[model samples]
Target: MRRKSIQNWRRSNSPVLKRFCASIGKSLGLPNQVADYWDTMLGGKSSSTDYFENYLLSEIDSPIVIGLDHVEVIFQYPEIASNFFCLLRTWNEKAKYGNSLSQVWEKLRLVVVYLTEVYMPLMIHHSSFNVGLSIGLPEFSRNQVQDLVQRYGFNWDSDQIKQLMSLVGGHPYLLQTALYHIWQQDFLLEELLAKYTINVRIYSEYLSEQLSNLRQYPELYAAFTQVTNSPTPVELEWEQALQLQTMGLVHVRGDRVLPSCNLYRQYFNVSASHLQEFHPKSGRAEG
Candidate 1:
């Protein structure tokens, strides 16, 4: 597709996207034709985030609640998550008031649509799900996922909790994304996190990208080192957080990951070559 795949799409916020999507959609009263053409180009979302959005975008919007379990689903397809993260940024920048991304999430239809279409199919077949699943989080036994969520203090009624735990585990990435999804989907935020788990391989590519960034932008690395080496606090940037989360470099901890993990801790953590092998998309690593 000329419209680059998920990865390229998330790489940056083209200043023109808002204007582009809006101009096309508004000019035609609804870019039905463009959207239809997109359907053909992208294969019409047979089973993915776009599928969910197809239905969700037309529904309610506001005061939605999300649990960590929900975030796991969104993470399953990180490419699509750019929209959610971007929407969050947009809301943060202009909310018609002073609310933050969290407040806007519950009312966000675009993200909800994304979760319903792309991730649910994966969830339906998995035994256990977590953040690592996108990293891909292996589906676990039913009992395991339930237990993971319970541990996080989110009370998913045993009845539909499975829906929540479908994508990932207790891993911070999955945990945070799950939470974000639930809010976007209009559910109650019973628990902040419903599960946890670990999948290191997916993170390796993530590490590579980080190192790539460091190498590409030495100044950025220098900025990071100042924060890493100093006791003084560092200001957080939503733009960077959006990039890292999209690249799978860190988990979502209340909107920011702040670099915490074994991968993050060791030798300044530049071993993407080692980690890439285990990734679902990337082949196995060498000995």
Candidate 2:
């Protein structure tokens, strides 16, 4: 049977519970009455849950998948995020009753996508995340990177690919961006790698954004600086390490963490130096 899919509801755009319910209602092709009801309910957590359950059982005839993208945005609003996720978990539980109601509840599926780990506290039994199958996408492997390189119409030899990987590791975004620029801008691989610092024109914007994000949390910034400055992996506080790993800034192995790519190390090292130069007493950048 064909499934109905709500491509995504970016929580960042509708963080409020009522707005969130309205977005879902609209996506499900529900009439204005549903949205009006949500607004009228004043976004009561239980009311919103019951509304979705009743609506799906009565109106939705086919399986529907709701995709919640950029879910990390809600992490900033812990109360709402906790209540919202618990509501989802409750719905999932309702699907397992082995009755006619279960059939309707089973028709509703969810696809939640986020960049960071959920650091906010959540009860194990009430979290949808804890109950779902978790999938982690690691950096591309050497062969996978080569396959992508060839697909970009490059006839780069093993040595050239190795050089590129040495600078950016197997990060798909960094690798793809570099390959595209090299192919389209006619830049020689060696020349590009030679100028592969954080200030390089191609990567400055992205690198700057990462730096800005790191600066927001001074402790995380300091922890990451330690990782970047060390030639070998360094052990950090567990939460700091996990947060950095989630930010795609560091790779964590066992109790040790290291910069995710040479690009990060090069950039952050220069940044740290500049911070030391300007703030010699503290040797740390202010958030």
Candidate 3:
């Protein structure tokens, strides 16, 4: 089971073909048959990505959705990232163009989710992803937030609800976290907001991780810094806007970019302050 996990399969430096084959074989109740073929295939120099493509083409008979969450993790490993994305792009193209393997390939639909546009770094061909459906999930609306509040059995008044929305901007994760903490721990609503100024520990770790990611990408961090300092939406490079959107850190409207919600604005204000303190000369007022 340990060897069968996808993370282990991708990260392991050891040969994955045999382990992958063994794992899937057991799941499909064809361990011996898969092992026999893997033994033979391992002797060749065929690319693992190509081999996986062929395996999918041969194995899939019905509709299947291959969901990949937090795909940004792969971006850290560029060689594997590029090949895997290109492989997915090719599979999609094959499905669209009708090839020898299109019959099975067409049955496979890839759903890649990430906090940043992984394709930016890979420079994937536009035709690959452009033809497929791209759905951007929206933030929770007022009614949705109300529904959640009611379900949580919180007797929050309209004013309280409005305040919460004003602070978090109906962001699903933040709203849920705020509500959960309020309901479970019996924390005062006013106190929570006041505490946010001093601590922001509720979202500290998540914000820290996001800030850490931004630190690795200096240009992206600079764009975010501009967004944070501004009282209104600011224009940014298309790639920068997309990066912020994917990270759930900002809302993009036409050419303007704004911090997704007040939660981000408050936390990132501190981040921006710290960045300026350490590298004051590097700070800019605008993007």
Candidate 4:
């Protein structure tokens, strides 16, 4: 499902688990009376684990795929997150048991998408993330970017593409945004790159969102600061490096880390003073 649809629930005053169940019930096409009945009956005494297993088995008769995007927001609620994820593992395992109920569970497929690793601890046996066919999308290569440029009907030469890649690396979203704006004649390629770091017109919202996330975790903010400020790759704590790499903010080479792209380095560097406010003491403080 779209992240925006559920993101507001995360910030709501009501209990997250209730909102979560309500959303699921709605997706299952249960009427409000039935859903509310279940909520009133089970909300106080049981967890989502019980609700999903019992309800999904009886409710669904066809193959159902639930795609959850931006699942990282749930990490902030560890108890609910852990319980829900473990429930997913249980559902998957139940489908493999070769019992009558297996047929029901086998019809249920899950697609959980998140930007970063689960920093929080989860029992391996109970973790659904470990069992899935994980797919990690790598950044586009230079050739891929060039292909995209041509696909966008741009007749730019190799050097022009190179200059654009140098600024945004091969980030798909950034490349698309730049290409779209230039294609619309909003700015020339040279003008776009020249004013990229200074102007907030292109990547202001994206950069601001990343900055806000980093501010939430001071150690991550500090670790990213070091990576951006350095001329060469810098060493970071294993967890810190992993988290930053997963967040698409930095690239890890061996034991060293560097900014993922010139865009990140330039944008974050300009905001370095603001970042320093998050961790005034050390740039390498552990999160």
Candidate with the greatest lDDT versus the true structure:
4
Note the residue pairs that clash in candidate 4: none
Residue-level lDDT tens digits of model 4 in 5-103: 456766686665566667777877874333333554555225554565567446867788778887766666666567667766666666656366566
Q: Which pairs in model 3 have colliding backbones?
A: none
Candidate 2 per-residue C-alpha lDDT over 98-204 given as tens digits, one digit per residue, 9 for 90 to 100: 35567667777777777653333334323566766678688899999999999988898999889888888888878988898888865868888777542267888
Scored by CA lDDT, what does every candidate get?
0.39, 0.72, 0.68, 0.73
Ranking by lDDT: 4, 2, 3, 1
Of 3 and 4, the candidate ranking higher by lDDT? 4
Regions more than 4 Å wrong, model 1: 1-109, 112-202, 229-259, 267-287
lDDT of 3 at 165: 84
lDDT for each residue of candidate 3 in 1-287, tens digit (9 for 90 to 100) = 22135468676764444554455445544423433344443442234334444564466566666576776665666665555566567666767676666676666677876654232452543433465778777888888888999999988888888888878887777788888888877577787777775337777776777777777788888898789789989999998788688777789999999987777788878878876777688753434
Number of backbone-clashing residue pairs for each candidate, in the order shown: 39, 0, 0, 0
TM-score of 2: 0.80
**What is candidate 2's CA lDDT for residue 218?**
75
Please provide TM-scores, in order, for all candidate models, with all chains considered together.
Answer: 0.27, 0.80, 0.76, 0.79
Where is model 3 more than 4 Å wrong at Cα?
A: 1-26, 31-65, 95-97, 106-111, 115-131, 197-199, 279-287
Q: Which tens-of-lDDT digit does each residue in 206-269 have in candidate 1?
A: 4444565554444444444433443334454655544444434334566434443333433233
